[model samples]
Target: MNLLSAGLVAAVVVLIALSAVAIIRADRPGGAWGRRLRSRLLLGVPWGTIVSVLFVLAVYLFVQRGYWHWTDPVTIPFRSWSYLYPTGWLTSGFAHAGPGHLRGNLQATIVLAPIVEYAWGHLPQERGSQSFASWRTNPWLRAFVLFPAAVLGVGLLTSLFALGPVIGFSGVVFAFAGFALVHYPVATIVALLVSSVISTVVSSLVDPIVTATVSASPPSAPSWAGIAIQGHALGLFLGLVLGLAVLYRREGRPSAARVWLAALVFAVVQGLWAVYWFRGGGTYVLYRGVGVALVLLLALLVTLAAVASERPLISGERSLIDPLSPLQTALSLALIVGLALVAYLGLGPPFVGSASVAVVITVALRILYTVVVRIAGSGRWAFGGITRRHVAITAVLLGVALLAGPAVVPNLVTVGDDAVPEGETVTVEDYTIAYGEEVPNRMVSAIDISAFGETTQINTSGVIVINEDRHIWARQVSPQQLAYSGAVRLRLGGVGWSESVVVRREGWTAVGNGTAYQVWLDAEDTPTQHAFDSAPQTATPSIDGRTVTVVPDDGEFYLGVERGNESLGRTALPEVGETESVGRLLFSTERRDGRAVVVAERGGTSVAVARHEQYR
Candidate 1:
């Protein structure tokens, strides 16, 4: 199950468990509240869905109609995933481009969400005795208002300017997941657990299986996969911060200065959102930009809470209550995240994925850094040159960097005429020498293509799109050369060049456009079509030659010795007695004796060699 499914299941179980436990024994405090909960109720607009759809549409228009108007989902990611932000930071969330990505997110939302809405809608409200009207606001009102805004805002902010546009409601769904954690821990835990099971299908089980079977895995996630761990991390982090923050502010007293600091950040974020809003052209664009504003509001609240409590350095406030007291803060965070992750793992559909355990650990470390930094300083806020907390945080970040593995940089090395070795890894950091020839245009942005002679499996990928300027050609060189002979193969730093299969010249002469393309052989039986406009003056290419240079003679059209046509068909074997003599495949060859066959065409006839293998 993914986080969503886990959450859903846990919600049901909790609703039932709370009742079951109550039936057997006298009610505990809040037992009546539990009794009132029901499922399948919808309140408010499907605001989340509407927001999700708008983002999907806006992103589509950006890709389809925006200046960089290459509307293809694959290419948006192709340019790079990290660069997707400025063009769409907000727009990525609006559209599904396809049904599958859309349906999956909707299922998770609908299934795992009822408990949350019910809990929010039914929470007991505080009443004003007789003066004003009574408002049905629960202790959760602060959390409800701020949580979604924070999650959406943070996720969008972090993921904006990512490699390409992404679509899905996971961010908002997760926001609810975060809120559910605070209100209904048991239900949330169960939901997360189920979600974990479903999530495994994509991350651990399904992916690895296909990869192992194909003997392959891609570098980084695909552009269209809509997997936003970074955004998820931000959402999860904010949910955690807000859950504790709201209670800390309400239950604890904070100084006024800290509140102001929080307000300042809010204003800044709002200004930025407004700028984006005006720049965006449509209703969808405006709505997405508003999401950024909502995010700013949440950030402001967190800042205020932080300042009011005890984090003097951030809010420039003197804490009246030891900055929210470390224990309360920890409890608040634990109270929310613990319940949420559990439900996500238990009952949510597998679509709600989790980060690496290492990353989760990183979250704790980051929180610790903030805590230590606040505690160690006794003097004025944030002006210290080097506090113990800074040192600790630095140490942790540096450690993570060191442990993450050096990102590999790729370069091509030629062994000989057409052979590049495989399985060797190199980083761009390792290279110092300059280029001998102009580097291939494709490699300018780090695309690596080591192409070869034949064009078999190479043509099958939809990823290989063709515009007018694109063309494919054969790469032929010997593996025998000294330069590439010692050179190594590529590995995935998960970005840029480095292919799974290395092309050796001795293999079928595969083809590519020298750059920006991936090529591979689909058949070994295929002939090496060495087409020429005219005859070779002699056998110009010799075994001893390093490169065979071909030139056309004036009006003297001739080709090398007889061989079946290799260019126009997918299969290597000719179609029984088929010939390329006519413009189409309608003409067939008639076998006369045995050596060759006579090809009958519309106006006349041509001959095709009947190679022994094709005789049947």
Candidate 2:
């Protein structure tokens, strides 16, 4: 290493060592910090959290083949696309899109999951329970087996019930936050900040220094545009349910106000409040106000569900709770979700349809309340043995239903129709890669859904890949993405196999008109295919009563001189600083005003015709 770099590394090592020594001294024998840690943790370490993070990292490096292709990995087959695709459902939760995605999730998991594991504890937490009394209460079993097993189960559940084509460990990360928030509400928020700091530190260590200059960057949607809101909410609700049950069993409670504030802050900062809808053709509409209000509602509902009193909402003389109450709550939750799914499929705009479903649920709940009051008036069973806690729990379940129910309709759909657009395509076994403009998106059109005058059948432009067998229909590269990057390579694989498809676009922009371009696709074991072509573009410049046009055909570009559809002549476009003649028009490429342009002249009068399109 260089002398300066070596010195920096040594300095960092010394600082870390000093910090460790200080911590050890402060936590010496009988120290308050040591005793406090022991109360909630084994050896002041969260072993379950450590193992869980390692497990997720292993999946990324090996299963996703990210070790070889750190930034680009085979992700098409790993997405939770449809119920028929069991491989996706089984693996999608652990798989990630790329290294940055994996790193962000792992950082959050490492920082926040420890709090949850600590709250769970290696020691038995239930009242009157002793450590090592049984397999359930064994410290080793809980830390190494039960905790990891539950994480895996929850990961699978998130994938099974998540919305269309979701991949990443973020849903599980949100679950960790939810569970931690219940026990240490304020501490969970603090951990969020700490996780950000850890991410920054890791990034600094990786890069050390950076250089930047003012330049145009690739066009991209908002970062929150693509978040899987449904999956995240489902995970959060699942965690909250589990956390509340554990808290009740252990006879421990945290402040409701703290829980509410923590939930709200976490939701807002983490972008759970970014409610959005796809507008197709590479666009989206974010409902910022609505999302913020929903965050408020979620916090309130979670607070109530976790801390509401155990007293019966209706005064009762009966000493025993109704045996059917639990069953009724479960059935109601299931029924509401079913109705919401049906409504989503039949109604307009998903958000509007979900709102209508909410109205139906409210009416149904009111009717149930009326029936309970009438039955209680008869005094057969007092208040049907329903407590405030039961009602609060039901409200929480309903919120979960509202969050996850509509996702079912989209997940049930498959690309049963022709997915490949009619054009030149390169086929690699079951996969077909093609490029087209203004073609209907098969993923969105698989089912007819419309909202805000925008239908799911909106047309998209760019590279598309399809695999009917795996229920895969994806726009791998968008028009803006390809236009900005000039080319892209994507990998498609399943299990232990993988193949690559390369897409390239070349275009020349008219001086004042649109660009003419051609797209090509190449796949393993297949010849390079001319995937798409656009019509000739005419430059808005008249030189000596003649106009120049750029015509792209069969992977070649031509310069044509025409006057009102009467072509004077056509010739191959010349290289930069080269000159070519077309009939009476002289065409020469030159650099003009920081732009490469083609100049057409005849007899001293010259005009700029077309400019070469540039991409970063």
User: lDDT of candidate 2 vs native?
Assistant: 0.79
lDDT of 1: 0.33
TM-score of candidate 2 relative to the true fold? 0.89
What digit string (tens of lDDT, one per residue) describes model 2 on residues 221-278? Answer: 8888978887888888878766765665556578999999999999988888888888
Candidate 2, residue 342: how far the Cα is off, in Å: 5.2
Residue 488 lDDT in model 1? 17
What's the lDDT for all of these models? Answer: 0.33, 0.79
RMSD of each: 19.6, 5.0
Give residue 280's error in model 2 in angstroms: 1.4
lDDT of 1 at 2: 67
* TM-score, cand. 1: 0.35
In model 2, residue pairs whose N, Cα or C atoms come closer than 3 Å (at least 3 residues apart or on different chains), thus clashing, are: none
